[model samples]
Target: MLKLLFPILVMLGFAQLTPVSDFFTWDRNLILQGEVWRLITGNFTHTNLAHLIMNAAALMVFCFIFKDILNPKKLWGLLLSISLMTGGLLLLSPIQSYVGLSGVLHGLFIWAAIEDIKQQRSTGWLLLVGVVAKIAWEQYFGASASTISLINANVAIEAHLIGACCGAILQLLYYFYTLSTASDAPK
Candidate 1:
């Protein structure tokens, strides 16, 4: 709904304003030094306008595909969920810094694809396979060499993996919930 999307558009715009992104980008040592806000804000910031537009467009597509499910509050929760997973991956690794919403976009796509699966849509399986293939490609080839040209930065592929894993966990939780509720319903 416009109610949810309007705010996201606004937030994304806010992220692009000068001076704000510098304070928000994820920096490993900075985090270790206790600048904790980066954990959440980094995902909202971007390396450049192209990078922001790419990620924002992907986010819009995700929202449209899963609009039936991702209302404003739930969208915020999903962002938070994937942000933690991506942040944890960055924290545990030797990698010093990173930024972008692509990581969270992966999780959102995976989550939406799983929802498609629950509805028996073939697109679900296709999306799941495509996502896995993309991750595998990135892991093997390394940080999507091509993105360096587009975004002027290397990709943190691990973030994509972590987000996918988190999305799958969300789907698993829903699976168990459905099974439990179905069994509990009186005949």
Candidate 2:
């Protein structure tokens, strides 16, 4: 587990050392200027120390529980899918500029929760509860609104919602795939 976490920690450390303005900048400048990579890389770059710490802590906590059941290959697939979908959604947004891992976190939580449920594990129910509560908190309490505004940060609430939806859809596809494959197996 430490081996898997080391690279992420190192990347975060490097991100911290760089000037945020150099890496965290986003806007029409990025879109029209053709710096489209910002759509994806922006999620990895935080506006400040607090933003990075909060996101990293949440990521670590979620990974601890999810890593146990999810093989590395599946985990990579899920992350890649979520990142691609998130970038696509952000590109469609009128806000023009946004950044942060909140959408990915939401996608991960949704995916983990669904995987747990499909396996009929109690942990899935707990994760579902957690994701729901997080959604409620972010929606009503505005806890995320502050960090969301740091750098042309347009909250990308739509992206987060879409990511969760995509995760759930993927879970359904995986479930049906497993079922069909099992039924087709030789007795």
Candidate 3:
């Protein structure tokens, strides 16, 4: 968990130092201008302290749930895969610019929740139901209103959907791989 928090804390500090969010947000125009680094860095940036705090809380929730299951390698793999997939989907869509870790948090939550289900833990079903409900609510109602007007950012439902899908897909692959490996082991 420290492995994940270290970078997020660093990025939060970097975001505080950056006066212009455009420097860290995923902007289609700037990306077209070859500022491709935004694809990765944008995941770490937030609109304001409130936004950062919300994201950090969400990350902690997911990390705490998956702490025993996620080693450094699995954590890194999930982070990179989910973020890359989220970026790819954003680039193809009409989103002009975006910031915050909400999207990645959705992915992390889904991955951990599914891992719980695979282990026959009841919390998995509860988490899955909550996630599905949240996504559905977003789809029907647009972005949920944030009380933190200081941050003043719109939630990108597309990012959440893409991230969740990627996580679900990754978990499915992991499940199959585990099954195959177990079956192949000599009795």
Candidate 4:
């Protein structure tokens, strides 16, 4: 597990070296100018220490939970899904400048929930409920000023939704593949 996550952690560490504003380097002007790489790169960039910490913490927790169940193969699939969905969301977003791992976190949460469901785990629905409620609160009420205060903040709620959808779709595909393969095997 560490082998897979180590490189991401290292890349995130290096990303911290660059100024926060650099993340917005591929903002409206650059996109208009045809620098498309930003759509993908921006997902790796973060604006501040707090942002990095929050994202890193979430990544650690989720990786710990899903890594064992997904194994190396599914881990790679999850990572690929996160990257592709994040980039797709960024490209579709009206907002030109943004940075955070909220999208990936959403993806992980959805993936985990779906996995639990496939395993016939009762906690899966609970987890799904919790995630949905939290997302709803964040989207409708905004981050509570009293509980979690954010400064100079702009939340890309759309990215979170899109990433979750991507994760759910991937999980569905994985579930179908597993079911078909199991059935096809000789008894």
Alpha-carbon local distance difference test for all models: 0.83, 0.69, 0.78, 0.71
Estimate, for each residue in 28-143, the C-alpha lDDT of model 2 and write its tens digit: 46656787666556666666677677778877877787778765566567766776677666666665665566777788889888878878999788878877776776657655
Model 4: lDDT of residue 113: 91
- Between prediction 2 and prediction 4, the one with superior lDDT is 4
Q: What does the lDDT read for residue 42 in candidate 4?
A: 64
lDDT of 3 at 54: 81
Tens-digit lDDT string for candidate 1 (1-187): 6777778878877887778888888888888899988887788888889999999888887887778877888899888877877776678766688888888888888888888988899999999999989999888888755687889887778778877887887778879999999999999
Best first by lDDT, ranked: 1, 3, 4, 2
Winning model by TM-score: 1
lDDT of 4 by residue, 31-70 (tens): 6677666555566667667777778778888888766685
Stretch of 10 with least lDDT, candidate 4: 143-152
Q: For candidate 3, lDDT tens digit of each residue in 1-187?
A: 7876677566666765576565778888888899987776677788778888888787777777788897767777787777777766789878988787777778888888888897999999999989878888887887756633656867788788777877788888887999999999999
Q: Against the correct fold, how does model 2 do in TM-score? A: 0.76
Off by over 4 Å in 2: 17-34, 144-156, 176-187
| Top candidate by lDDT | 1
Lowest summed lDDT across 10 adjacent residues in model 1 is found at 86-95
* Candidate 4 Cα lDDT to native: 0.71
